[model samples]
Target: MIQTLKLHSLKWLCIALYLPFSLAAATLVGTPRGWRNIDWLDVFGEGGGALMVLAWTLLILGSRPAGTVSNLIFAGLGLIFVSLWQDNIDEFWIIPDAQLWDTWLENVPMPIGVVILTLGLIRWYQEQRILMAQLSKRERFRREHRSVDPVTRLASADYLEQQLDVELRAARRDQAPVSLLLLDVDGFDRINRRHGVAEGDRLLQALTDLLLLNLRDGDLMCRYGGDRFAIMLPHTNETMAVIMAGELTAAVSHFAYHTHYEGERVRLTASVGLALALSDSPRALMQRADHALADAKQKGAGSHASAA
Candidate 1:
């Protein structure tokens, strides 16, 4: 309480000094002469500056998305607001009459703020474009984090089924084609045995990155199970899925994986299965894909195979 009283006493002393200076200033000869009778102009102008400072601080601190363009826009507007407040405050105080420095103090920060805000915004746009490309598959998981897979950081099997269901209904209505591509590591059990489970986990992470790189923005990829991924292709036909499956096979077959502990290159392959909805429910569609993947596994042991 004593510290608070001391601070309050200091504040009162500052007010006492400033208040006398404020009262001594002669009123300006303006057409709206009645306006100078009250100190409302000074109060409002100072309030405005205080509010602008608050806004600018919030924008600068809160806009931390690494060059936030949206934040730049907000900050530029705040600068303009503060410049106007400074200009307004000058009307009440006529310190050393006819001084140009007061106007400069009011106006210079505006343009500088604009320049800084513009650069920040441009960088933000570039970063956003790059991010959109990198996490393109995550578009399907937008505004909803609950359905995302904790392990792979992609959408889960449940999300896949939900999306497939929605896309299937739309396809049936518009006569557009929608298909699913399932990919699983070939003999993942053996890899786990040879490299240990931790290494196997690293392989899965590598596999996830490779798959994400190969997929388009509209396509959805999910972790269906251990060392398995499912891709939902909207407005895609069986032939397109086949071609993509082939590409996935090629990408994984040639993927050069290095173990962190051993620094040894571990090669891995994936078996893929393609399934078209074909007027089936989401459950039935998944069953068909599962069976197709099983068929691909039985026929081939080391390479990517397709099911009938």
Candidate 2:
């Protein structure tokens, strides 16, 4: 568990030692106030707050992966705990007027900790928004697990067809345009041959995450087949779909996929095809997209084509 926490135990130990050292320093420089003169209420309140903050820090370190946000939060909480601990110590000890370091220790860290904590919280909120978007994508297909692809955790080809039919009917009723994007991983077979099938599966999963991040709300993505993905864009015209397809292709080309074994970074590229929903049937629209995809592949890697 300590190893899994990625050296958080060392951080915790350091903080724990700091508290005692701070108390020892205060005792060394200051005289203990009489029992009647000590403010027991202030000590209890500040001490309790410090303990609570310490608990929260431990909870965060245990639950979250070690990253920038987690580190900021942990450091911020540790500083706050130190400030509170110093305050509690001050309640029971009387420092000389000449000693200014104790005052700095109690006052300086609180505001700095607050500022760091606020920044961490803002970053955490943004992270949660991205995670929520990803979760919503998976939640849509949760009810029909049989129609979800295991590798990418995306909807299957059958589910994509079903959603296409539904979206097409709604588009016709509203007189709005709908578009389809077909994306194919370029040289995926070569990747599989060079880096095992497990690595290939991981690459597909990473690609799925990238696609989800680029998509807007209400867009549906599905694993069409082995290395092909289909996206249904409601209310999107051919021009917008084509632009999105080009962006996705560029994003894939820039992505660096790493191998699990040798940790070697591999660059990947994709070909994308865009088709407007002119036909009433989902099968016809998919066929047009598929034909366009073949044309895109012929043009070479990272190419995009739009069907008329």
Model 1 over residues 203-242: C-alpha lDDT tens digits?
Answer: 8887898888998878988888778899888888777888
- Candidate 1: clashing pairs of residues: none
Regions more than 4 Å wrong, model 2: 1-133, 138-142
Best by TM-score: 1
lDDT of 1 at 49: 72
Indicate the worst ten consecutive residues by lDDT in candidate 1: 24-33
- Candidate whose lDDT is highest: 2
Cα lDDT for residue 141, model 1?
41
Score each candidate by Cα lDDT.
0.71, 0.86
TM-score of 1: 0.61
* lDDT of candidate 2 over 1-308, digit per residue (tens): 55546657678788978978988898899998989998778978999999999889877788787788888898788889888988888888998868898888889999999999988988889987787666665434334878778899887888888888888998888888889999999999999999999999999999999988898888888899999999889889877888899889989988888899999998889999888874479999999999999999999989999886
